[model samples]
Target: MTLALKYAARSDRGLHRSNNEDSVYAGPHLLAIADGMGGHAAGEVASKVVIAALAPLDEDVPGDDLLGKLHEAVVSGNDTIAELVDQDPDLEGMGTTLTAILFGGGRLGLVNIGDSRTYLLRDGQFNQITRDDSFVQSLLDEGRITPEEALTHPQRSLVLRALVGHEVIEPTLQVRETRAGDRYLLCSDGLSDVVGFEKLAETMQIADRQACADKMIELALQGGGPDNVTVIVADVVEEEPQPQATQAFESSNNHMHPVGPTTSPPRPPVQMPPQQPPPHQATMQQPPQQPQKKKKRGRKIAIIVAVSVIFLALIGAGIRYLAYTNYYVGVSDGGEIAIFQGVRGTVLGVGLHRKVEGSCAPAAGPDCRPLRIEDLGATNTTRANEGFPVNDLEAARRTINTWRSEDQQPEPQQPVNCPTPLPGSSATSTPTDVPSLPGETPPGSSTQPSC
Candidate 1:
């Protein structure tokens, strides 16, 4: 079955901004939102250019060809904006973030750049489909921070990649299967930054699309929309026969299907026939369209599987970091006490840690100790402080020495065991020395597990 959308979209200047720097387009199969950046009227121009560039993909595109077509549209937008910036020095920094979706042949073509977002609401679970190309997002990916931390990060607004007049724009693209009851949302950061995802999921459950879009806008306003806000709320419904004229109609306007690449503005609407032809007559001129289901499977199940794999990968990484980076004073193969950087034994077929430079000299080998624990692979700054386990390597040597000194002390003064001197000759046998720890030397022996 062919996939399509029933969507509503709106753009607001917002409470703080004097003018709306956001541009939006919503249609049966094409939905997009752009948030422009820069001062002066450049923001508006950039956003408008982005929407103009992407407006053509609304027409029906086959699943196999959809990805290429989407790329062409985005490249056109990037080039147009870059050319404008080059032509005018004042608009040099002006650029816009574009997030759009093309739905056809039961799959969605996703194109994203900058911080604008795309989200999917399936099976009562809301999942963000696109990742942001921002600085804080990199931190999150590196495991330095959690998703909750990224939201309120002071530098969250600092985007690393955007459509700004770059010679080359690296836009993110993906294709996913679309379902009959699925709902998709595209919005500018003005709405997303202020509105929490929980609230969005709750409000999106409203039956009416317009009502849902309005509620989202209202929530952004209540949160003091600091920038221009744009929203598109679209729900996928069962495909049905659409009248020929209605195919050209959009939620915002009766925009015609853009034919070819041109710098010109939106084309004038085509005049319709006075008498509408029967639905049967329309089919004769055009072949029936078929939806191409590429890898159409259980979407939520796929999500769960992907999430499980990612979670396991993260846990495995954390465990390895903890095990491999451990450093402490321990016994070496030569029976000499020394500081060890890695874990004592092999785990998962890898050493716990390696020897690093430090104050304690390596007696077994001629190598030196690491200057700090960080030299051993604990790059995260949070764990470098005094709270670190065995952080004081020099002090650790002192503790190990105390243990050795106690072991060397003479046994407590107590009553001696009197043995019966039988007539046999076994009274002269000496007592054997007792060992203290695993791999430890005899009590009188010098070397042991120590730093």
Candidate 2:
């Protein structure tokens, strides 16, 4: 089956920011988010330039060439930034984080730099698929801090790498197979930094992509929106075949515009016939002719009514097909996890889906657990209320199994003390020499806790 993306994109200046410094694009073949950094409005310029440079790559590319095209485009963007800096000394420090995905040959080619992120929701699992190129990420990788401590860490925004105009930056790139029901999210650190992963996962579970995007922005704003936020949500789905006639019409008329008075040539004045004397009422009546006219009018009305009915029927059938082909995992009326068929919510107050069966089947596997809403915790319970949409019944089952496995895992340990710095390491240097971690006093300062 042919695969295509159904996607939505959004950006917000945010409650606290004076100006938006983020750029985003979502198209049939590409999705990208860029978060800019600098001063004097240079950040905005950096992001816009990079986005414009990459926008042309939204067209179809051969699957094998996807990564090559993405890499070339990114390097070109970086070069453009360097040129701009040369033209204007004031823009010297401008740069931006880029996270983008190109779709081709039923696969995804992803490119990332800086702290912007890409997350995936496939089958019944959700997780971040890109590692951040930032100092905080480095700290986490080295086991010097826990995920929780990293959030409030003062240098959380200290990016170790990005598309600065000074040099040709190498970005992380990879390709992965795509599935029809997978959902992907690309966003700036503005959203990822403020919104917890649990909230993000729950919001991504929304079946309506547009709604999911909207909720993500709202969550960022609620969390004090310290930076400009941009989000792109895309879903992979089987492409529906279009009638050849419709396709032809669309191709021909897509750019056509209606004639307006300003552009149209002056109409020739209508020639009028000389005024005629009124005919007698009897002659004007034309009784036999009137019957023929009425018959023709009746036939036209009947034809229009028949066509209208047929068109409506076809539309209803298409909607029903879309509603039934998907499935979701949600809490049932009895509060137990259950598998459902069809889309969530309703049309004209009629439910669009029904419970197919309880998610937990004792005989299915040892991992199967009868989970209820009360047991799911706040974030997961919220997800259940919204429903975790999946491609099919099997996907729904996998999601349930994933939840069961997570439930069986142990609790996380508390944050530990920061490790001692190695000789000549940056960690022991003064702030001027190198950035210092949280809870670590710079040289000449009073002693403090090491965590």
lDDT of each: 0.63, 0.71
Off by over 4 Å in 2: 241-451
Residue-wise lDDT of candidate 1 within 302-401, one digit each (tens)? 2333244234434545555576556666444443444566455664454556655333445525543223332322332233332234655666555444
What TM-score would each prediction reach against the true structure? Answer: 0.55, 0.54
* Candidate 2 residue lDDT tens string, 405-443: 665446687776777888878675454665688988665
- The 10-residue segment of model 1 with minimum total lDDT is 247-256
TM-score of model 1 relative to the true fold?
Answer: 0.55
Best by TM-score: 1
Give model 1's clash tally.
13
Cα displacement (Å) at residue 437, model 2: 82
Model 1: lDDT of residue 169:
80
What's the count of clashing pairs in each model shown? 13, 0
Model 2 backbone overlap count:
0
